[model samples]
Target: MAARRKAPAARARRRSAALAVGLGVAPAAVVVLLAACLPSTPPQAAEPAGPPLPPVSSRWAVAPPPAVAVAGANPSRAAAVDLVDGAWADEVAAATGIPRRAVIAYAAADLTVAHEQPSCDIAWNTLAGIGWVESRHGSYGGATLTKRGLVAPRILGPRLTGDGVAAIEDTDGGALDGDDQWDRAVGPLQFIPETWHRWGADGDADGVRDPNNIDDAALAAARYLCRSGPLGTERAWRDAVFTYNPLTRYINDVATRANEYAQRVELG
Candidate 1:
């Protein structure tokens, strides 16, 4: 497996530029500092939906039938969102101000991970926080997240040219990110081609693992987070989020947004 690319200071700058371009569609504005630092411990908090999610013995125990049954064009072969309750998604999305489609993708990813790796116990809101922070749930630059979970006119981060950023030469040869000279973080989750090559998932069971798809990206992010350890504990949660981006301010921002989403659900 390829080593994960270290997120560079350029990402902070790229995020600010992307967010600024899509201010109207962005849920919240984020101010990022261009400084690298170790991850700090975040506050202890309850999981988004209450207790830790129950674990499953294996994927076969919970994997749904491979039927394209979402009542729309380009339905997924196995969305796995049948595990999530529709009413609950509607309520939580409305309360937390997250897009309903994005909410479903996050919650579905959490539940799928629960089935695949029960010990991780990642939360949906945490994924939401990441989505909001990274491309505003695929709405960056006014990109449209269609009903099929595909982000049109896909989002791409700045080139990794070592010009105040990680000096990663092009790995995909312009295949995934359309840049042969240099690699750009692709899709809503802003995963570089090399990292995505190792961790990308077929979230919607569309037979194609695409970073441009919300369902795929959310699940991939969850799997990546679980690599740190179970997130039921505060230390573990902090560690997992830090692995995504090893910066104190980044971890704190994600924690704050995640906690806010959880709190909103409780208040409602």
Candidate 2:
């Protein structure tokens, strides 16, 4: 029998070319064929895709502590009134002096309204707190002489006073129109003309939501709180307090006062 003929080197080149074409890199066939003609190394393994990373948290500031519950007291009773009263006296003697009965009454009214409109719940305590801070239970008025000198008081009129100018200076550090009497903050609630225009309501049913009247002011505060929605959660409540005033200390103070009041009411 004739000896089997050896496969031609050209046949090997063709096979390599076919392999390269199958791999979508026909040009690489020439290199592979040349390597096969010479010495060759083992093929390397392909790398797999890596998994994706987890997302980062976006919060910047640390969240405040959860509001403390009143000691030995239920949150929904006469204890709440004492909690508010004693706390107000201890925490904010300068700006607020709300009676326990008033706060309890307001809270009850707010709860009743909340059944009809859930959004009002969060605002009830917050609004009351703000009112206490702003007017000291509606004891303050516009325009008075201070130790510093004659201070412009917030007067209800078409004109602003020197005291009004001073009041503006005190609150805004001379940024407002201190020269104009129209810049006065009105009523027991201290409603500036612009704020009154936007938020004023018929709170006492005497046909006006006057910020100067305690009843009207209280109602307006309740309405504002319901609108703000702070009562939903601790963060939201803190944010709502900050929105009322941009100061962190103010927020802390308000929360502290509220907690104190709640606790006092519980004890009483």
Candidate 3:
């Protein structure tokens, strides 16, 4: 991206005309005055942004999460389904201090449910990867998830109005994003209002469905990925991620970060 500025030439021209009209100055003199006022040559243009860098390795991404974090839910269930790598989440959290609650969510999303879709193998790290990209495990913008897994000061993305983002019209009647004119991606996982309405889930097995909840969003994301067929092969992974968001950079970032989280957590 380049920083754009208003050219001084236009302003100079306006001043030149006023000066020429106010005083009976010669046209040549006015021209000379304007020339003196304006730049000899155009200002140097701002440099364009560089091309998107390829993933450092298909297995890992390089960015670190934001340093500050809002307090999150306790996530200590009295009767919870055990994750395949249940202890791994606690291990990573103890090792890295990234919040055991979030680590548990990732592990559960990865291993707990088949999500009613047998073909897909949604990795916990992949969910963690998307979390890293989306809302930093619901700790974005100095906000945090409530103990119920609901995003407290719910995250809302910039309006998608076909400007540079998608051209999705409002689907929910301002129920989720409070925007009836246009659609906004809501919550840490960033689901557009309409999509959330259709796919809103209750991963915590709670009675109500809320897109703002990390458990619900994660399970919903898993369901979405599973809809794209099997995720066992690389092609399957690409297809599933493409279905989620159709940008090469997005998919690559997700894949890279997911793998990195996977590697780190799997250490235990």
Q: Whose lDDT is greatest here?
A: 1
**Model 2: per-residue lDDT, tens digit, 128-220?**
444445444333443332221112353232222343222222222322224332354454334444444555555334565454454454444
Clash-forming residue pairs, model 3: none
Report how far residue 259 has shifted in candidate 3, in Å: 1.3
Model 3 scores a TM of: 0.66
Q: How big is the positional error of residue 232 in model 2, measured in Å on the Cα after superposition? A: 1.4
lDDT of each: 0.60, 0.34, 0.50
User: Candidate 3's residue-wise lDDT over 1-268, tens digit each?
Assistant: 0112221110000000000001111121111111123343323454233222222233323332211111221223421224223344456666444556666555445433333443465555566666666677777777776766677788777665766555567768788889998777777677766667767777777677777777777767766666545566655565455455544555566666655544453332
Error of 3 at 196 (Å): 1.3
TM-scores of all candidate predictions against the true structure: 0.72, 0.46, 0.66
The Cα RMSD of model 1 versus the native structure comes to 11.9
Residues forming the 10-long window of minimal summed lDDT in candidate 1 = 9-18
The candidate, 2 or 3, that scores higher on TM-score is 3
Cα lDDT of candidate 2 equals: 0.34
Query: Over the stretch 33-141, how does candidate 1's per-residue lDDT look in tens digits?
Result: 1112223443345434322211211321233211111223122334565545566667776777788888778776766675577667666777877788777888888
